[model samples]
Target: MPRLNAGDATRREAAGHGPDFLEALARGLAVLQAFGPERRQMTLAEAARAVDLPRATVRRALHTLVTLGHLESDGRLFRLTPRVLRLAAGYLGANGLSSILQPRCEQLSAQFGAPCSAAVLDGPEIVFIAYGQPARLLNLTTMVGLRLPAFCTALGRVLLAGLPEAEMEALLQRHPPHAVTAQTELDPLRIRRRIARARSEGFALVDQEAEQGFRSLAVPLRRHDGRVVAALNIGMHSERGTAAALREAVLPTLRAQAADLACQFL
Candidate 1:
């Protein structure tokens, strides 16, 4: 059997022993994800390097994706076809989660004239599922399908806290924390302890860890049975106040909305 990639191995271990895991599918998805906003079209070499997969494996996946209409390619470069939007469209267009939470995020964002969003953990990153944009403070960096590293963001931390201990450990091992900014805490032990605290505290506060000049607070968005299905977060300009002040002023509202967000499951 071929050796699985780090991400593939970690995911299988996290789920507790799926011996029959389809490594092919995982590599295909990686190849697809390698084509992002910055990289609209990538050659086979670029795609392989981006995904850290073997060129042969990437070639098969890219060719399969092209044949299926999910990607378009000339002999040299490949880009995602419009049909790829269907994946995000399926999630955002769904009636339950985005429809229910977006208004709350919009109202909360309106209060601070900042951006607010809801996201779910996707392996080592958190993927934005919904966003609330205040007219004056549109953040182009965030939109539906946007993904950011999990160890640095409040939304990612909150979602990470929801995972089982084994799963969390597995994920951390696969995606080691790296400093994005000087303020980022990349120490593995520190991150583990912080995530443990977030689980008990029921929220996560990250200040300039994921991005400079911004602070975020997040709480888990749960289902009726208490499973954390996603996370709700408010991103505010840190120049307005210290993290402590932001906590005092906004944490209450953040927690309230996070708790209320679970009603979508009902």
Candidate 2:
């Protein structure tokens, strides 16, 4: 069984129902989300344990997903199928944000010789919606749906800076920061100060907090009306440059691209 984090546990407990809520649909989606990089495949019992549900209940959901072509099973372990991607495809196609950001990120990656990405804050995490990498290999690897804690990532810090102070404090209280590395700041007061700095400086630079030997710089993507909706970031190995050098080098380009993209949104 996969270990459930505090965020996952909280979400499960808050899966409340109203007149229009569909419990079956919710359970089916939960089952699909239970599969991750580690828990790629699971037996009926394993799936039930992962979601903290009954074996019989998860069995129905699993088979239902399999029948709908979203999952496949060898009569023992069940795993997601490519058809599940259609769900993400629908949103990407409709929003057109990914389509617009991909080329810009590609250009930025080529220019800086590092990876460039864009992400949006989701609850206590930041979800990468677009990413670009150079031809050469790097230590860090990220995808469109990758989720990282909002407290320790440069991209996340930028997004968090956009939130109202009260809401941000509440969110931090709900999902306290955990150390991703020795350098990660676990103190809530310090975390809040970093976010406040990002708000004042209009950008964030994090060093070896999310992953060892990696550093990232990010700026929020704001709409024409000046409402922040997402964040854009460039990441490179710490050995490549100092944080000051990285910010001085890429901040202009990052802010320029972000401004151009902001024009596209309402």
Candidate 3:
């Protein structure tokens, strides 16, 4: 084989191993993530570079997304539209857990006088799908489509802990770690240990990981086939319960709500 230039090598890699469900999914998600916090609006060149996609490929994808109303452009720059929420809306509409469990979360909140929520893993982050609260004073701040780091959230752990050991190990290897807070775990080995505990115990708890002064308990929402598709959580002040107390008081309610939500998948 003759020596190949960098561009040629990149092209060869980008061409991939041919089409499959995973490749198509990866490309679509790449196109979506090309628009981000800092680069909300981008020109064709910018979006292509941002996603490391060929310019023509990005252009076609952007055009398709625009036609579908998931993206909008002002002749020069493209940005996402509120219509993009419909993509996430489709998932929530199909998953009855988020729709049903939300009201129960409200009941749990009324009974315990705390806020509760449900979340689903979207790539490396967890997206809040539904929430219920007793009072609106505390700033839980998460919205329907808002995303947060999976590694730093109880909701993430509950869903992750439900994964097979090999798959979870692979995911940890792929993610490695980056510190989000003083309490964030940066070591994959340590994270695996915590996930193992969660898997055995059927729930996960976090204190001041995603945000300070907040505590949450989460249980996996399993489908009829016994696969966890999402996580259910209740959030409150860390002072609401000690770790033990959180497991005792909050975990049961979260588990009950998770059970109720699981029926929808069945």
Candidate 4:
């Protein structure tokens, strides 16, 4: 396939935006994301295919990125440099809430000897920003930057519970449930009822919705201004407790920690 020039790749990314839009910059960043653990290095052809861009365009962009030290190449392969972490660091440093919530998440993990995470709603997914994992050796892949479906997570439920009635209803209407497990709720009426229950109870507990054997309890993390800016959750395997037993045990700790974090946000 023919490769695109850097300018063309940028133009393509900003296809729908106005002429003043920084489409080229957006496309360049998207190209960086094309490399990951599974794809640590790629040739021009692979990079273009991965980001769905023209080969020539990706070639020029890669040349610019390589010169800028964001990407490094040894003739045959191109890989991202540690410089990428600086970009991520800048964002984390600016988000004061995530840092504020970290200690609370640590406290929750300490209390339960389990894993806990604090996240915010981003589109239809919950994106973890701060988390504590006591079993550091465990194979849990959920960490900062991991995004999971909101409808199937307790944190997601807590965030949804805080949404205004109209927006919440619209969200429900948009995503009529599909089952993640036999226990996952699919009916909008039932989902709405669940959200209402969460609002009334001041927390949410979900069992095996995103993945089998995983159970979680969550509460809204409210800011000083009384707006729910994020959610905090404690997670463990279902085998840790029976459905009823988990509710009685973990739910209280989750809510208390959420409240503790909320105070700081205020």
Clash number for every model?
Answer: 0, 0, 0, 6
lDDT for every model? 0.87, 0.89, 0.78, 0.82
Model 2 TM-score (2 dp) = 0.91
Q: What ranking of all candidate models by lDDT puts the best one first?
A: 2, 1, 4, 3
Model 1, global lDDT:
0.87
TM-score each candidate.
Answer: 0.84, 0.91, 0.80, 0.79
- Best by the TM-score measure: 2
Worst 10 residues of 1 by lDDT: 136-145
Give per-residue CA lDDT, model 3, range 1-266, as digits (tens): 35566875666578774323254356656887778678889998988888888887788888888888888999999999988777777987886766776777678778788777778886667888887777755565546677888877889987788877787777777776777778787777777777777889998888787887888888898887889988888877877768778778877767777776676865
RMSD of each: 4.4, 5.6, 4.5, 5.0
Q: 1-266, model 1: which lDDT tens digit per residue? A: 57888897898999886878777898899899777779999999999999998899999999999999999987898998989888878877774777777787789888867788988898999988788878876755658778899988999998999999999999999988988888999889999888998999998999999999889988898887899988988888888888998788778988887667666675
Q: lDDT tens string, model 2, 1-266?
A: 45566875566668754345555788888999999899999999999999998888899999999999999999998998989889988977877777888788888999999999989899999988888899785446558888999999999998999999899889989998888999999999999999999999999999999999999999999989998888999999999989999999999999888878888976
Clashing pairs in 2: none
- Looking at candidate 2, the ten consecutive residues that score lowest on lDDT are 15-24
What lDDT does candidate 3 reach at residue 51? 85
Query: Model 1: runs farther than 4 Å from truth?
Result: 1-27, 49-60, 139-142
**Runs in model 3 lying further than 4 Å from the true structure:** 1-29, 138-142, 223-225, 239-241
Cα shift from native, residue 207, model 3 (Å): 1.6
Q: Between candidates 2 and 3, name the one with more favorable TM-score.
A: 2
CA RMSD (A), model 2: 5.6
